[model samples]
Target: MGETGTEEAREFAHSIGPAFVKQYYTSLAGTSLSRHDAFYGNTSSFSCNGEPSILGAQKIKEQYVKLGFKEVLVDLEGGTFDFAPSHNGGVLVVVGGSMTFAGDKTCPFTQTFFLAPD
Candidate 1:
């Protein structure tokens, strides 16, 4: 990639961090299955909390709905992104945060994404 291309890639990568948080994590707290699905492709993969990775958008949606959290609040500490050569020029994004549940309990979280341009 040229300078402009790399710069665009970097910017694109940075943009996804907030967008993902808003679209997926934020909406998830509200239990919006459809909103969560919007951020993922058909073949997307998701894994967290040492559980088996869920493959495909449908499965991911099902898993989220099954959790049935009454409410969730994600407080993001921050995030960073970098190029992923192994993913065919995709970007690897990692975000750190804490999730507060309805019961007033909180747990630290780190989520990762391998994002490719559409």
Candidate 2:
């Protein structure tokens, strides 16, 4: 809600980054979604039921559920960075959650996604 609160939350998230990474990988094993590992320009822009947006808000709800994460609360904190595409076919996404996963990771809600050309 407040900027200072978000900042503190982000710092706490950074402190626990490794744990979250481990948790994320462990969580990934139960779902169909694979982590994004490509570049940005070539990737299909993320869509929320058809609307285009960087912060998906609620796009991957089912995917996360399948992955076994509790639904994200509204005050979590996080950051996201776009990756450069490896070749010419896939899109790369890197999203991390803070203490609350509030910023771009889970508050608005989104995940790393790679869209490869068919």
Candidate 3:
């Protein structure tokens, strides 16, 4: 583990942030939700729209699966940033974008992901 923040860590975060965003949304839109298993696990947690936080990754994935979206167009809009360096080498990514669902219905959404090197 390292201190709270460092220039080297911030640089590392910036380097990986956009690539991770691209890969994440691309996979979400084009692949089965199961393909996203690598992004979560028993220890991972998630929540959307301030709903009660789901405690584990599997359950969180289940919620997304329930949405039954066959296709979603993700537009990387404003607010994408490598906001902070967290415990160890983790990168905190903050992103805002639009998700176009079926029938051309689009919604603006922002998401934060803390990517930790495990």
Candidate 4:
């Protein structure tokens, strides 16, 4: 690609991680627990904390509801995101930070996601 086109692509790639993270976090921070379901398609799969993988959007949403976080707090400023571009125009995101479920309850976490472009 040309110089300006390359720069624009770089900037766009940088913005993708934060925007995706914001949307994902927003889904977890509200009463609408099912909002995140939009992120998953019928072919999507999810696995939590070494648990067996769950397939399909409905099942994944059900598993999340079962977790019943009710509340989720992340070390926003302290969090870090690593991104890698995929061959199919997707981005692999690795997020690391401390998470708190309630007052004085916190644990370090690292989550990975493959964000496929629409």
Candidate 5:
């Protein structure tokens, strides 16, 4: 991406980051995965902690489903979104946050997303 394109991508990514995070946490509170799937593309990649990378949207959904969380409360005040333009005409977004689950257990997590226009 050129300088102007990169800046535009950055601004766009910044504008959507908060809404995306809100929708994502809302999806985690529900049973359906469709909303979550909409945030990722077919070629999207995901990784958490030191685990192996999960490639593709279907596999990513499967991985999330396997977590088996009935509900999640995101601590947005403690979260951060860092965005940049990628070489493939996509925005690379890195997010970090703390989440509380059913048993009052909490964990910090960081996730990377390669978001492209569809």
Candidate 6:
């Protein structure tokens, strides 16, 4: 990611962190939560921190409710980067998943995001 992209990702992550963790623990039964990013143009593999589970999901939901967001969802486009606006005036997006397909085959890069709102 470029300078701008890095900054944007950091800001977005900070803004959404609370909601994510809370929601995971509260509603999804998630235990721990962590996040990472990969620039669209970067060659490194996409990465995320922490583990995911039903309890963790619930915790994430609780975090979301603590935030101002009324609703949260993972709305992404086909590209590696996507910007999603939250009900709390914040934005959630996928920073990287860019891969080029060949011979009618899809790229190996895969990323997934879930949202929870307060």
Top candidate when judged by TM-score against the true structure: 3
Quote model 5's TM-score: 0.74
Better of 4 and 6 by lDDT: 4
Query: What does the lDDT come to for candidate 1?
Result: 0.66
Which candidate tops lDDT?
3
lDDT of 2 by residue, 1-118 (tens): 1232355534543444444445554544433333421222433344544554543324354434533344333322345544433234333335544323323363344455543434
Residues 38-116, model 5: lDDT tens digits = 6667777777667998887788888877765446667767588887766665567678888787778999878776666
Show where candidate 2 strays beyond 4 Å.
1-63, 66-70, 74-78, 99-111
> What lDDT score belongs to each candidate, Candidate 1 first?
0.66, 0.40, 0.76, 0.74, 0.71, 0.38
TM-score of 4: 0.80
**Sort by TM-score, best first: what order?**
3, 4, 5, 1, 2, 6
Which has the higher TM-score value, candidate number 1 or candidate number 2? Answer: 1
Give the TM-score of each candidate.
Answer: 0.72, 0.28, 0.84, 0.80, 0.74, 0.23
- Tell me the tens digit of each residue's lDDT in model 3 across 34-75: 666567878888888778778777787787776544477788
Order of quality (lDDT): 3, 4, 5, 1, 2, 6
lDDT tens per residue, model 6, 1-118 = 1233466655665667545534432331222223212111222222334444323434443443443222323222443544554444444544443322223333333344434232
- Each prediction's RMSD to truth: 3.4, 15.6, 2.0, 3.4, 2.6, 15.7
Error of 1 at 5 (Å): 9.9
Candidate 4, backbone clash total = 0
- Backbone clashes in model 4, listed as residue pairs: none
Residue 67 C-alpha lDDT in model 1: 55
